[model samples]
Target: MTSKPLISVIVAVYNGSKTLQRCIDSVSDQTYPDKELIIIDGGSTDGTVDLLIANNDKITYWQSEPDNGIYNAWNKALNHAKGDWIYFLGSDDYLWKRSVFEETSSHLFKAESENIRLVYGQVARVTKNDDICCIEGDSWDYTRRGIVADGICTFTHQGMFHHRSLFETYGKFDESFRIAGDYELLIRAFKEGGAALFINGLIVAGMQTGGVTANCTKLVKETARARRNNQLRVITIPWLISYAWAICYPSLKSLIGDKNSRYLVNSGKCFVAVLSYKKNAILEHNNN
Candidate 1:
């Protein structure tokens, strides 16, 4: 790859007229010159097509057609992407800063040297009330050990940058998965010993507290399927338990205040810790 390889930023949308412009503007205003914006719209009828038409000059390539789901849209974006690195963003999300790609160029080159196919950074989450919360990249481990043991996704899609070759090697996102496809893709890459690097800076601002993953039941179920498909049965047990807990959590929060609900949740954690400690102590005594 060239020292300044072209970075392709892909945004997948569906009736996102409200937030589409902001997403386009964020990419258009990037300090990095060697970058292209590609948009894959899922046949939006909410004036989103008109907005894209208005800003056609800014986009490298764009298309509007009905797709199965977000992952399918992303796969279409991948087919059109012509950059050395590809970054996916939702129409509701935007680059966190104009210099995000500029600032991360050196790290990207370093990753290339080390044969790392994935790089991700921090993300600023914009809540429903417009409050911004910075989520750090190192907030959780994305290493193979961490993924297999925990069966959880540590990185957010908006902040992740993928070497275009990753798709060719590991295969495209499974369109069959309505949700959790990103998680499943990462699990496959990690399991295949793909190297990933983390950059400690904000890359994108994600509109949070919504989306398909917001449906807790569906999220849990899809996540379980992803884990099972990846042969992560050890983590499946805890995942199922967590799914049941999630189902009851909303009712508990509604009955109790947020503060009391949190306290109750912490109490359960404490109980688990006590049991774990006792079990370890018993095992040590028996070994002695």
Candidate 2:
């Protein structure tokens, strides 16, 4: 009989003692036997190291040191990972269910034969209180055009599994990117003809809101950089509009205050939705 492939779960955290244990527990509770947990701490001073010590037996490898950012920490963790498939989990995020690895491995086994480098599922974005905001993810076929054209990341990293071959071929995450380095790597791979498989209706993890990726303006700026780094044009219409919105959002927020800024933003979104509805309605009438 053949041995099951090992999956490495890498978590990068800084001062996340409040939720770190839950993240670790999520991995430890997994039904998959062939899995390892690797954690990289960014010199957290908030007793996070103590928690790491408490759960030392459950971790395959862990380290505490100062790092530039999340990508840097992830790069560090990657050095110690020995699994066939790699998944990056956030400190504030948890596996949606204990069977995540068990279920995902089924697809991975098939993906291996097909030479697929990326396998992704859906992620639920949840509030701090555990209320789900929305589920995020889509097939590469549905998202490739947007990613290639505008550098928009439709799938959450927490829900994606990367084959070790991907790292061996394309190299690890770029350490300089404070955000969207994942996007750069994915864009590079897809644009270069790497294959990806999407597992339909598989909700892999729950990503908590208000993390580093929640900085919309900074994320947008990093996204543009990621696109340019991958040789993608920065002047695409979708990117232009997103860039404009990102640039204006902060100024508008500071000028008006959080409450009003949110109202104004929601109002703008509603107006766009209404226009889209009206246009669709007219088109339907014409066709009828």
Q: Give me the candidate number with maximum TM-score.
A: 2
lDDT of 1 by residue, 1-288 (tens): 777978999888999998899889989998999999999999999999999999999999999999899999889888889988999888888887888888888878888988888878877556545565345345223333335445444456888889988898889998889988988888887774556777765545554546675565676678778878888763543354556655876787679844454345434433443444456568879999
Instruction: Please give the distance, in angstroms, between residue 87's alpha carbon in candidate 1 and its true position after superposition.
Output: 0.4
Candidates in order, TM-scores: namely 0.83, 0.86
lDDT of 2 at 279: 62
Off by over 4 Å in 1: 133-136, 139-146, 234-241, 248-288
Candidate 1 residue pairs in clash (backbone atoms < 3 Å): none
Can you give the lDDT of residue 4 in candidate 2? 70
- TM-score of candidate 1 on Cα atoms, chains taken together: 0.83
lDDT of 1: 0.74
Candidate 2 global lDDT:
0.82
Tens-digit per-residue lDDT, 14-126, candidate 2: 99999999999999999999999999999999999999999999999999999999999988988999988999999999999999989998889888888887899998777
